[model samples]
Target: MSAVIEVVSVINAATGTVFDLERDVDVHAESLAGSRETATTTTGRRQLTLGDEVTFRARHFGLRWRMTSRISAYNRPHHFVDEQTRGPFRALRHEHHFEDLGDGRTRMTDRMTIRAPFGPVGAVTTRIVLAPYLKRLLTKRAVHIKRLAEQVG
Candidate 1:
């Protein structure tokens, strides 16, 4: 079975503005508050588009890893999805969603599905990782984003 982790947080920023922030790859990296280190192509464009290939180097739980992903889906100021082309997981799919809370706040959710490379051993890996740990990581990331967005204006 594949392991899935979903985390949601409320960002005290306009829904539209928050949505725009997620669309820019650089912004997303920055909102993580230096948690991720990235490099771009010769074009030097930070905004992401459907089918764009991007590479990211980030540390999670003190473990540094690199991921090369392609933007599998993009739908303007609403939601976007990315899938890993080359990385640790046998399969990795991430979906970013934004919802309005009717008070200038945005509810942002991250849904991640990962299939570890070691087959049944991956199931054991998931158990070891625990959903709560993954949730905490996402929560920390959201907090950083919330602070950044709220402070921007």
Candidate 2:
């Protein structure tokens, strides 16, 4: 079974600024500092664009994981999609959407779809453990991004 997780965050910054921060590799690393995540390939510290691929190394659940993701879709400050080429999960897709609130704020939403590796057992584990863990991780990342974007604006 595949698990889909959605996380929404409101940022007190412009949509463009929020979108830029979302694709900034350096900001991602900083936001996920607790996971010790790093961009191991591509334009290491640059913003990701369509057709750009990045490999990330991170420690999760007491294990080191590596995932290569490609920018499958891009549409300025509106939305973008990243799909995993290779990763710990059997499959992974993350879609980021940004909505301008028309008052210097943006509503950012992350919709992630993930499939585990071990078939039925993995599906059960994903539902019991992975889902909550990922939700928390996503929440933390969003909060960090919001703080950074707000600070810069």
Alpha-carbon TM-score of each model against the true structure: 0.83, 0.96
Which residue pairs of candidate 1 clash?
A: none
Error of 2 at 18 (Å): 0.2
How many residue pairs collide in each prediction?
0, 0
Q: Over the stretch 29-60, how does candidate 1's per-residue lDDT look in tens digits?
A: 76555556563532457777788878878787
Per-residue CA lDDT of model 2 for 1-153, tens digit only, reads 899999999899999999999998888889899999998547654899998999988999899999999999999999999999998889999999999998899999999999999999999999999988998988998999899889986
CA lDDT, every model vs. true structure: 0.75, 0.92
